[model samples]
Target: MFRQLSERFGRPVAMAILTLLGMWLMVMVTLPQLQMIDYSFRPNLLPAQLGGPEDVWTLSNYVTLFNNEIHRAIFFKTLWSSVLVTLLTLVVSYPLAYYLAKVATPRQAALCILLLIIPFWINEILRTYSWFIILAFRGPLNEILLALGLIDRPIRFLSGDGGVMVGMVYAYILFMVFPLYNAIESLDDNQIRAARDLGAGNVRTHWRIVIPHAKPGIATGCIMTFMLAAGSYAVPALLGSPGSRWFTQIIYNWFFEGGNWNQGAAYAFLLLVLCIGFMSLVMKFFKVGLGDIAK
Candidate 1:
């Protein structure tokens, strides 16, 4: 349809029409998201008692964000944990993604890729709960450890960062794997063959050819995995120490438990902004926009 329109109406007109249509579509999607931004800064006071309607303007809500220690801690924890998770996922996923995309046979490649995707099909919450079955004191891991005489008692895997990172990596592995895999898969195998044929060894071929080609995918996978793992609530709630709460859990507390919607909105907005900024940084560094994956 676009090709026909370009021929009939001329390419520039067709481009203009498509651009306008794209903008309209974007506006439709983006307006509500922007409204969330507006709501984040909205005043918490009821304006009917003051002078006007409920949505009357005020900066009090946003100001509270800076004043709250609980809010500060949650934000920091989420940011720090996410950064660590991103680094870990990159280390774990890159080798696996590279091997699958570059070295595996057709059937082995499909099976390996399928193994990564299979867990994602399960509900995330259920997957997190499944970890409880493995890590709980009375769980199979504990039973096995005791039988092996590795410890006098069960280990507290689910009570700290160890459990949280494990669950996070489990849930987010696909995000890391798929992007890196797609990025590696798109490279021309002939380049690798030529490098090998020219007497470049395995290490040289990968270092000079494979890693450069897979850079975008690696960046994308890290960005996505970090974002999702950081913002996630249920896994942290289930796996993390109740005393050491996650940021998302804290946000939930503010919204529902604390009965402070304004503060909750502020927390959410801060998280969203941080994620966007990181994504922009990744795009700038990689010389590829987030949309490039789609392209």
Candidate 2:
């Protein structure tokens, strides 16, 4: 990799790039992870007694997570909710991606992309708050339904996880769309044309040709969407009702409210494990290798 980079750029520039990447891996990723793992193993202690005998390593934190029924339920709920969001996002994104990559002209695609990006230019917190406003019982959506005589009264959209789901899908669908677009854009037009000429229908063409070629993108997009939704704090905190508390909220409480950093680290470590396990499952189901997605 270094040799290829050095050839493309200069040796000095390549070395500089390599150095920056190394620093990022160590400082931003590896060190923090090591610290979290270290914290997870030790007992939660008073600040002054952190290095005292009472702070000895133990499995109590991990064991507590499994033994606590409420936390365990929250963890599973977060996992299932993230999976649902990922699947829903993929369903919505694949057609839009196909339209932009294969159906629309370059100018049209650019315009569509610009429209999509314009909303994201706003801060994510502001965007989530926008959903919170839109999903209130007397909000525009309910008013519209009432005006159309579709309903006699306002639906309580914010009474459950529905608002949070809407926010998560809205926030993360872009992640799915772009990957699918890039993969589909790289496909040869001739293959699609040839398939049609041989009497293949749209479903058959996508099932046999397009989908197989786009497996890596599907895997990457699903992984990204699921992880983002599962690890999400802001959207859920804003849109979720009391009944829809996410696992991350529990982790936050453990760290800040409970003043138990060890337990928080353990919970966080479990969430990380859940995400990695989900990623592996997606890759296997798609028959995509890590190298394929990297490409």
Candidate 2, residue 271: Cα displacement in angstroms equals 0.5
- Best prediction by lDDT: 2
Estimate candidate 1's alpha-carbon lDDT, on a 0 to 1 scale. Answer: 0.83
What are the per-residue Cα lDDT tens digits for candidate 2 across 13-53? Answer: 99999999999999999999999999999988888997787
In order of listing, the candidates' clash counts read 0, 0
lDDT of each prediction vs. the true structure?
Answer: 0.83, 0.93
> Which stretches in model 2 have alpha-carbon errors above 4 Å?
1-20
For candidate 2, which ten residues in a row score worst on lDDT?
50-59
Error of 1 at 277 (Å): 1.4
TM-scores, all candidates, are 0.82, 0.94
- lDDT string for model 1 (1-295, tens) is 7899899999999999999988987798678667666767766555455444666666777677679887777678788888888888888988898889888998999998888778788898899999978999799999999999998998888776878888888889888988888989999999999999999998998889887888888788878897898789988988888755778887798789987677777778788888888888877887887677564
